[model samples]
Target: MTLGNWFALLVALVVAAEVVRALRHRAVRQERWRRFFRLRTTSWGLGILTFLLAVALAAPLLAPFDPNRQLDIVHLTNRPPSSTFLLGTDPLSRDVWSRLVYGTRVSLGIGALGALVAVALGDGLPFAALVVAIGLTSWFGTSRLVRAEVLSLRQRDFVVAARALGAGSSRVIVRHVLPNAAAPIIVSAALGVGNVLLLEAALSFLGIGVPPPDASWGNMIADGMPSIYTAPWSTFFPGLAISLVVMSLNGVADGVRDALDPREAP
Candidate 1:
């Protein structure tokens, strides 16, 4: 009935949509995925990403306590999780879980958006000029290194064959070179998402995070630090959330790496 409740409900709906979409992909693209089905790593990557994402999204609806509520300011200060509050209250008496859920939304949104921005900054846009742009942006300060590497790769038989087949330089770069180079970039982007979450929490801890009544894990940590000697749960749960989210991203990236690179498999 409160804003936290509504926020949580919105999370639940998004999660349901994600689940449905994943299932639909499985059904419709079953054969397509199966061709690479030996790629258990891909499935694992997607599954773990889906799981962590669902957990973060559903935080509001599933969390028992009203995350933003200020409980008994006196007795609740520094108290650990109990029947009364599954995750202890902060210095301000707000529920740690609620703030955590809201924080999840902020962290995930920023990571996703930031990665997209990075990707879009590449020059492969509406025209061939964009390809030049992408090249410039991607190589930026590393131009000398990239040029040397590309020169070496250009001598490979595949590159020679592609050139003979009438593939233009841009085509070769897009089809051949980029694919080879993308492995590390994709891995780095996915793995870095957890770092965004930590940053969000830190911001909240400083009281500069999400505005009041919205709740945030960082805010919870900020509130709990003084009471850490009393109610460890205040900081513990949010810290745990940050750890788990980061670990999940690591797992997802590992799975993706294995799936994409067959040579890595035994």
Candidate 2:
């Protein structure tokens, strides 16, 4: 199988495992969800993320024009928002709204996949070299966090009882240690998504990521730089996108951390 195929399979398996785990702890999961939704910032952040996800998923239907297609250069180039074009046009007469919608897919996909790889494998390959690089480099902190949590959890009474009840090391770790240590892992992964998004944008801005014609927020901002004074929307919109996503992710992460806190558990 190809690298992408393997990655997909891994993600599927991880998601299935999580679903099974949640089902096994349905009441706890429901309570946690309640706590999570109760936070106003969490709801707001999740609302924004849900909207972006919908836009990304429906890009073909939502975007009026092809993100990379340049049209009517003489008349459409650098045009501001209007009835014909919502976010306006770029230097090449490409629709900003279309590019922005498609860019949401690129940004969120990379951020989510990179965070999953970092949290799951701790180190990985080059299916998407940028994703792999970001995941590999960023996992160290998460690994340390997991390790500390695991170390603390290993000595807990439940873990000791599991081992004493003839459970093997693997069983003890999976059934006793990991489920308890999961809170920090989840929180770290949530925060890591924002970090990965920022890193991807920085790399793209430096011309090393998500190559041209692919409307990354970073490169879009770079493209808008020369026209900043005359057509500020070009750079402004992309910068605003980055800021909003990063901030939303941070807020969601904070909410998840609080919601998952043992102290907050009923």
The numbered model that scores best in TM-score is 2
Over 4 Å off, model 1? 1-49, 114-155, 206-213, 262-266
List of clashing residue pairs for candidate 2: none
Q: Model-by-model lDDT, in order?
A: 0.60, 0.75
lDDT of 2 at 123: 29
CA shift at 127, candidate 1, in angstroms?
33
lDDT of 1 by residue, 129-198 (tens): 3223333343333445456557777888988999999999999999887766555555666765566566
**Against the hidden true structure, what lDDT does model 1 obtain?**
0.60
TM-scores of all candidate predictions against the true structure? 0.65, 0.78
Cα lDDT tens digits for candidate 2, 82-106: 7677788988898898898788877
Positional deviation of 254 in candidate 1, in angstroms?
Answer: 1.3
